[model samples]
Target: MPNEMNKKQQEIKEKMQQQKYQSKVDNVTPTPPLLKNICWAFVVGGLICTLGQLFTDYFLGLDLPKKEASACATAVLVFLGAFFTGIGVYDDLGKRAGAGSIVPITGFANSIVAPAMEFKREGYVFGVGAKMFVIAGPVLVYGMVTAFIIGLIYWIRQ
Candidate 1:
C-alpha cells in the first residue's frame, strides 16, 4: 500500500547518499614515491650548473671575453654530454640518480643521441645516422613552429 511505497523510496535515497559519501572519501590521491625523488634532481642539476660556472671562470681567467667564456662553457658541457652518452655511462648514471641525471645539458644531449646510438647498432649508415635525430627533430620542429607563431602575433600587435 502507500506505506510500503514510502519505505522503498527512503531505502533508495539512503543507499545513494552512502555511496556518494564513500566515493568522496576515496577520491583523495596518495603521492607517488617517484615524486619524492624530485629533490635529488634539483641537487644534481645544481652541481651541473656549478661545473658550467667553473668552466666559465677558467675561460675568463685566460682573458676570454665574457661572451666567449659563456660559449666555451656551453660547448664543454655539450661535449661532455655527447661523449658520456656515446660510452653509455650517462644512462647508467640516470638509473642510479633518477631525475638527478636528467636536469642538465648533458641530459639533453643524452635524450637526443641515445636513440640514434640504438639505431646505429642496428646498422650505422642504413639505420642509425638516418634516425640519429628522430627524437629531437620533432621537438625542434614544434619549438620552431610555436616560436614563429608567437613572433608573428607579437609583430602584428606592435
Candidate 2:
C-alpha cells in the first residue's frame, strides 16, 4: 500500500512540474496580431484582383471579346507574378501580405516560378525543368483529373 501511495505521489509531482514548465514557455511566447494579419491579407488580395480587372478592361478596350479579354488578363497576371518572383519582389510582398499574396492567380504563378528559380543554379534541364513543377505539379494534375471526371459525369447525365 505504501509503494502504491509513493508511486501516485511521484506521478502527481511530475505532472505539476510539467505544468510549471508549460506556463513559463507560454509566458515567453509572443502572440501573433491576428487582426493585422487579416487586414494585410485582405488588402493585398484585393489589389491583385483589382489589377486583374484592370488588365481585362484594357484588353476589352482593345476590341478583344470578353472571353479573350479575361484570358489575356489572366496571362498578364501570371507573367507579372513570374516576373516579380524572378526579380525577388514577390518574396518580399509574400512575407508582408502572407496569404493575401497567395490566394490570387499571381500566387499560383509564384508557386510555379519560385521552385524553378531556386533550382536554376543546379542547371536548366535537371534543376529548373525538373523542379519547376514541384509545387504546382500535384495541383495541376488533380485539377485536370477532377475536370475530366466532372465533364465525363455531365456527359453521362445528358
Candidate 3:
C-alpha cells in the first residue's frame, strides 16, 4: 500500500522530509542579532541615496535645469550600472546591499551596460555594444511612446 504511491508523489514527499530534517539540523543554537540587519539596511539605503544626491548635485553644477538635472542623474545612474556590470563588481555589491545597489540610478546604468558588454565580448563589431541597446532601447522607446500617448489623451480631454 505504501509503495503504491506514484513516482512524482514519492519524490515530492522525500524532498519535503529532507527539507524538514535539514531545517532542524541546520538550526543554530545562537541566531544572529536583528541589529545587524537594521544597521545593514540603514547603511545600504543611505549609501544608495547619497549617490543619487551626488548625481543630482553634479547635474545642477553643470547649470542644467532642474528637470534636466534629474534626467542627467538617471543617465548617470544607468551609466554607472552598466559600467559596474561590465566590471562584475556590481553583482557582488547587489548581493551584499540587496536593494541598496539596485534602487538607484547606478542600477539603471548597470542594466544598460551589462548586456552590451556581454555582446561586445562576442565580437566588437557585432557583439555586446551592438546588443547593448537591447535593454535601454525599449525603455527609451516606451518612455517616448507613453509620453506621446499621455499628451494626446490630455489634448483630447482639453
Candidate 4:
C-alpha cells in the first residue's frame, strides 16, 4: 500500500513539474523601454546641471570671488541633498530620475546621509556616527588611493 502511495505521489510531482515548465514556456515578458529611460535620464541630468550652473552664476553676480562662489554653491547643494534625504524626498526623486538624480556631488551627499539616518534608531554613537560612512567611506578611501597611485605613476614617468 505504501508503494502504491509513493508511486501516486511521484506521478503527481511529475505532472506539477510539467505544468510549471509549460507555464514558463507560455509566458513572454515584454521588452523594457531602454531608449525612453535613456532620454529621461538625459533630460533630468541636464536639469540638475543647469540648476548648479544657475546657483554658481547667482553667487558670482553677488560679487563673490569665483573660487569662493563655486565652493559656496557646492555647499548649498550638498546641504540640500542631505536635507532632502533626511526628509525622504530624495529617495523618490532618485527612483524616478534614475542616473539623472545621481552622478552628481549632491548624490554623494545623499548616499552618506541616507545610511546615517537609517541607522539613527540604534543610537547616536553606534547608529548615526558609526554608520555615517558605511556607504561613502570606501568610495572616499578608494578615491584617495587611486589619486595617490596616479600621482606616483606620473612622478615615476617624469
Highest TM-score model number? 2
lDDT of 4 by residue, 1-158 (tens): 99999999999999999999988877875655888778877887788778888999999999999999999889988998899998999898888677887877788899999989889899999999999999889889999999999999999999
Summarize candidate 1's per-residue lDDT along 39-65 as a digit string, tens digits: 666777778889999999999999999
Cα-based RMSD of candidate 2 = 4.6
Q: For candidate 2, lDDT tens digit of each residue in 53-158? A: 9999999999999999999999999999999999999999998899999989999999999999899999999999999999999989999999999999999999
- lDDT of each structure? 0.83, 0.96, 0.76, 0.88
> Which residues of candidate 4, in runs, are more than 4 Å off?
1-32
Q: Give the TM-scores of the predictions, in the order they appear.
A: 0.67, 0.79, 0.55, 0.75
Every candidate's CA RMSD = 7.7, 4.6, 5.8, 7.1
lDDT of 4: 0.88
What's the CA error at residue 46 for candidate 4, in Å?
1.3
Better of 1 and 3 by TM-score: 1
Q: How accurate is candidate 1 locally (lDDT)?
A: 0.83
Model 3 ranges with Cα > 4 A deviation: 1-46, 58-64, 98-100
- Could you give candidate 3's per-residue lDDT for residues 1-158 as a string of tens digits? 55766877989999999999989877855775557755665697687778878988998999999999988877776777777787799878776666566556676676677776667668966786677777778877998999999999999999
What does the lDDT come to for candidate 3?
Answer: 0.76
Judging by TM-score, tell me the better candidate of 2 and 4.
2
TM-score of 3: 0.55
